[model samples]
Target: MVCGPDVSTHTIAFNTSFCHLRDTSAEADSKLSTLIHEVTHFDDTFGSFDSIYYLRESRKAVGTERSKVKTNADSLAGYVVWGEVFYAS
Candidate 1:
């Protein structure tokens, strides 16, 4: 839980694991992916972040499902992996 909208606190702590990469551009930050992925999980019953719904998406076999893969954002959970800047699912 390095990316923390820490419970009972007013801060979101980012995990800087990608900071050491030679690609210092913002696009190189891995957190961008995680943020887009988890943002889709906000469709939960409470309209908030929920793992139950997250796991449910992982079970979808129709086409694009959610877990932790970079593809599309609105339909799955990711930004465009090719030729684009972002996506959300």
Candidate 2:
């Protein structure tokens, strides 16, 4: 998915696979999480977070990646996803 740096433009394009899965009612949990991940990027201030943030939240599992968790916007969004999903239920 490609999210435009300018939120005011409100431009977001989901890849075919993400669209297919979301449209077909597949991977419900992951789809929601991924949606919020994209939203995080969109909500980011003036696209300031993009240059340094990693897109793959899964990378947090790696020991080297752990050090950057505090600065990782993706990981922060992911953690929010998990927390929101968990508490909302």
TM-scores for the candidates: 0.30, 0.47
- Give the residue spans of candidate 1 off by over 4 A: 7-10, 20-29, 38-76, 79-89
Where does the lowest 10-residue lDDT sum fall in candidate 2? 20-29
Residue 7's lDDT in candidate 1: 39
- How well is each residue in 1-89 modelled by candidate 2, as lDDT tens digits? 54443476656676667654442122232456555555655554322243224334334333454545544445545556544322121
RMSD to true structure for each model, in Å: 7.9, 6.2
For each candidate, how many residue pairs have backbone atoms clashing (under 3 Å)?
7, 0
Q: Pick the candidate with the highest lDDT.
A: 2
For candidate 1, the lDDT comes to 0.36
- Candidate 2 whole-model C-alpha lDDT, 0 to 1: 0.45
| Residue-level lDDT tens digits of model 1 in 1-87 | 346343344344545654543432223324444454445434331123433223224334223533423332322332322222222
